[model samples]
Target: MTKLTRTLALSIFALAAGTAGAMPRPMDAGRVIMSDTADRDVAIDTSTRWVNVTNGQTVRFDVGGQRFTFVFDAWPSTDSVPLSAIAPKGVTVPDVRVYIAPNPLYQD
Candidate 1:
């Protein structure tokens, strides 16, 4: 191959490797905080390896070998479901606000 073509191919390969190496790492477990209309603080902890839900809200998560699903409505009106019961094994919980909930509750 010509010198110019060889250099071009090398540059492309380097760029591809760099891009692939820069991908973001996945999370294991954490809290997601949000604000209410009244500016009240709310947070969810995924430390239990499951998704938690509260006040008739839905909990959903995709982790390891388990497809996580939960509902807080089964609990008392003042109660919330714990994440430990629903989270997958060895899966990290991200703090990102990727899920939608009509009602949010803070965990202690």
Candidate 2:
């Protein structure tokens, strides 16, 4: 089931992006702030896992056993969504927000 879930997730998300000609910057990446509540804390370590998704596009992420899906509403002024807002019918997931920054981008 994990293998199948991984395969399905990989096929659904467009993960490859070119950063060759990007403007002079220390780093270009986005962070997914996960939580069970609306409040978020700043990370002491300046790094995060990143993903490149088109503006206004809906994205799905299968983390652990939870399925999180949300729309990248083009760099929102406040980019955070609660599980209640994104859940399908009775299904629920964690909170997720994506934006630029440097953070630990690790795969588990």
TM-score of each: 0.26, 0.28
Task: For residues 1-108, write the lDDT of model 1, one tens digit per residue.
Answer: 999999999999999999984522112222222322222223445443332333444444444433344333332222222344334456455443332233545443
Q: Judged by TM-score, which candidate is best?
A: 2
Task: Return the lDDT, model 1, position 88.
Answer: 45
RMSD of 2: 17.1
CA-only RMSD, every prediction = 13.7, 17.1
lDDT of 2 by residue, 1-108 (tens): 699998987766634323433332211222333433322222211233433444444455554445545444423333333333434445443343344222123213
Q: Return the lDDT, model 2, position 72.
A: 40
State the RMSD for candidate 1: 13.7
Runs off by more than 4 Å, candidate 1: 1-53, 77-81, 86-108
